[model samples]
Target chain A: MKNSPTKNQISSYIIQSQEEEIKRIALELHEGVGQTLYSLYSGLQFIEQTINSSNMKSYVNEMSQLLEKTIQEIRLLSVELHPPTLTTLGLVPAMKSYLRMFTSTYGILVDLDIEGQEPNLTETQKITLFRVCQEALGNVAKYADTHFIQLDFLFVDNNLTMTINDNGKGFTVENEMQRSSGLAAMKERMNLIGGQCLITSEIGKGTTIDVLLPL
Target chain B: MVMDNLYNQTYMKQACEQLQGTIECDFVGLAFQESKGPNIGWKYASGNSNDKYERITLRYGKGIAGRVLSTGRPMEIKYFPQNILGKALEYPIMLAEKLLYAYAVPILINGIPKGVLLVGFRSETSISDDEKKFVEKAAADIKKFLSLEKM
Candidate 1:
């Protein structure tokens, strides 16, 4: 008789499929729509230069500006969906770029500190770490209502520990865990990879999340 | 170029107020792509409970305003959070305003959709066809106002 998968196994399968779908959509947005918009922008610029009538030229200029905005929007969306750097440059660089964009978008200052060299990690490990940070940062942006954050990456011995701290209005961790799926997802992601995700927060104090993965 | 001189926040606020009153809705908002910025944001609102909408910036195809701008069509949600395609949180305006129903129409400029005019109700009430048409007409009027300033 064939054995049925356990609950944890089913959830892991779902998470993996979700990541794959996100990657596919990101690729379509970047390579398909992004390229098409770029060509349209170039085509409009060519027409703007070739057109003789001032009225027509101004109209083309407006169209070009709209297309430029659309292209930028698509680029940002695609990157946020699935950063290309995460696959090519590894975790540290990918997190750095994502934090930069996050700061620009939300006006939150992230003080990122690293200790020791980045340990070699499996592809799943790298993505899992990146996603945990992404989810934590997103929650901070949405609910923390703070301007400053601290991110620490410590690679010591055979373990990689990442700490995210926010100086914001915090909530009761237990209540939030029950109320928010984002928090649950972060914990589930860490558990799936044999890692630990610790979240501690008080009502008036700030929040801190520590993720530790054994290498 | 000409937009810099004619972009009036007061006019937008007043338009939003008038639309809110006309539709008998709890909230009315106008979201547009700033000429100098790549993102879309709610610039004007009427009957807003809080100013949180100002902090929300949406990329194209993300939220209601973004969806309308991209599709160049009107969108309606009579029962929000229920029977919706995406998460209720994705529609920040609705969530922030506690909106139960919403209708958004695109404001076109030079034959291209450039902005969104949204009317929302806090109560779960279905908008009549006449009300939808009124909102669309208001969007068209706003489009004309925007285009007229460019010339």
Candidate 2:
């Protein structure tokens, strides 16, 4: 099941469909509701100026604060659902931006490094790799009780690999692989891209997830 | 919007500090039910080793935290380490944190539980009744905090 073409094709089909759906929802949230909220915020700014009374202005200010949080939340949600940068800016930039956001939002520091030149991969492969990284980071946040996460994307010798490692309380990989859907999903995503995922962990040590794709 | 996040961070820091000091627990966390989803997960944690508390999206009534959310009352587990809490997956925070004794109370706003305040010990010990009361008191303070949000 690791490198089965049939599985890849099927997984690709299913993932493509899901991506389409998620893309649609993300666009709606970003372009549709996001624009509306942006406009609403503009209106509040107008109200803030027009309302001369200090108390009234204070009320407007609070409302504006709340709306701003909502807007940021929507934007974050949209990106999480479908990262526009992954499609437009390519993988390296996408991961950099994502890790920055992850650190800011979750207070988990991540160090990302890229080695060798970027390998040319299809849109499907790129998204698969990005998704795999996302899943790996998520697992680190959930199960790994560590302050630092490390990511490396290397392209060398006609092979592309991404390793996400964290210094957190690690679990037994075999036992967790069977029970954790997140770990399984990361593996499945790699398999769908005709790549292999290797997960290693030890109790009280840390966990490392590696994805290797043949270029 | 950034201000709201800052405020939350400050509040969480204060809450956790006070709660852990009073409850004598190694760690404390707060989780709110998502407005868009029927799930609750940790939003802030003090003395936290990781973000495991933030990663869970518990459905109401599904697990220990969920139970507290559903019942809108305080609950305490005297012993842990794979004890009953629905399933292993449902207790990710406990499994990851290796908490022994735990207590949680609902943060109610206008009589509806909107969030939960959890405090736990890393090593196992019999939880005293006074410790449970401390949790309840912390929960009440949190409830007041939520009420301020309504204002």
Candidate 3:
């Protein structure tokens, strides 16, 4: 308590504290709420197996639908807290899963192109790249009014490059950065791993975000 | 609630207006997620004339909308033909839409990307750093709400 100052230092400490708190809540959602939901889902499945009636099955199906939705919500909450895929599987798999989910949810076509061989990246690098792409995709969903978006990954030698391009109502890049923090956050996250992020776009055209990292 | 409907419309409207206001450009639209993807690219003409941009189906990586739909990221550019790569010019959303300067961002959730949010300026005004930050923040906020709705 004594170490926490009210001005710059305390503010940073408070922010850190806040992030930790969010993480804790996320963890709780995973451990407590997620488990409870999973239990409920399993119990419903058991009941679904025991009962046999075509008409009753239809009603059960409705209940199952609601349960499925609840399960999906719980899964999303857990993922939002801390993605297990990122921890167990690596960034590539996590990204692929995320892309598939994106296409299904938004009814958008996602063309994912992976070029060259992908080497094993450090956990830090993988997480950094994942977060950068995550944020980049976030921008696209919230902003780009386009039907198609492409995420391209190229690994040439020791350098890795990721390009996210979209064709929507394009705005001035300068003004976007001034008004929006998503781009800056993406750049900052990439910069942490000694990478660079670039954005290019046009009006009535589209926008593209390029991120480069050294392997 | 009236506020809820108003809020939704306002949100959609503001998304278009922000693009119009920031870039000092005309023509704003929103292509939401449809069963068959963003169908019939509706030119959200809150500020511009409702002339000819209503009947369009955007493909992935072909036009401006298609590219954003495919990539799930933000974009910005000044000169269209001069700056656009020649080989990737088959898409008509850019030229057909008549966008000059442009910026777009993806609305994402839980480390996943959904749809895209876009803004455009018909002129060659340089997009500053601050503008990008604001757009990104707005996109994130919107995505959060969308995710909540999903839940």
Q: What is the DockQ of each candidate?
A: 0.16, 0.11, 0.03
Task: Give model 2's DockQ, 2 decimals.
Answer: 0.11
Off by over 4 Å in 3: A1-32, A48-61, B1-151
* lDDT minimum window of 10 residues, candidate 3 chain A: A6-15
Q: What order do candidates take by DockQ, descending? A: 1, 2, 3
Candidate 1 per-residue C-alpha lDDT over A1-215 given as tens digits, one digit per residue, 9 for 90 to 100: 99999988998889888888998898899889999999999999998999999989988887787788788877777777888777888889989888876764554679999998897788788888989998898777666767679999999999999999997789998998999998998999999999999999976679999999988
Off by over 4 Å in 2: A1-7, B1-18, B29-151
**Global lDDT of each model?**
0.82, 0.75, 0.64
Q: What is the per-residue lDDT of model 3 for residues A55-143, given as tens digits with 9 covering 90 to 100?
A: 67756654554455555555554554456576578777778877755554344467899998777887667766876787776566545
- Please provide, for model 2 over B1-151, each residue's C-alpha lDDT reduced to its tens digit, 9 standing for 90 to 100: 1114677668767988888887677878888856553335677788776664565554456446667876888877667744675544445566556677778888876566667888888887656878777778877877776667667
Model 3 TM-score?
A: 0.52
| Model 3 per-residue lDDT tens digits across residues B41-137 | 5434445442334444444444455566556667766676566644223333344355666667766544433455666655666567887777677
Q: Please report, as a value between 0 and 1, the fraction of native contacts recovered by candidate 3.
A: 0.00
- What residue runs in model 1 are displaced by over 4 Å at the alpha carbon? A1-21, A31-33, A53-70, A96-120, A136-182, A200-208, B1-7, B21-26, B47-52, B96-98, B121-134
List chain B TM-scores, each candidate.
0.92, 0.86, 0.73
Best by TM-score: 1
For all predicted structures, in order, the TM-scores are: 0.74, 0.67, 0.52
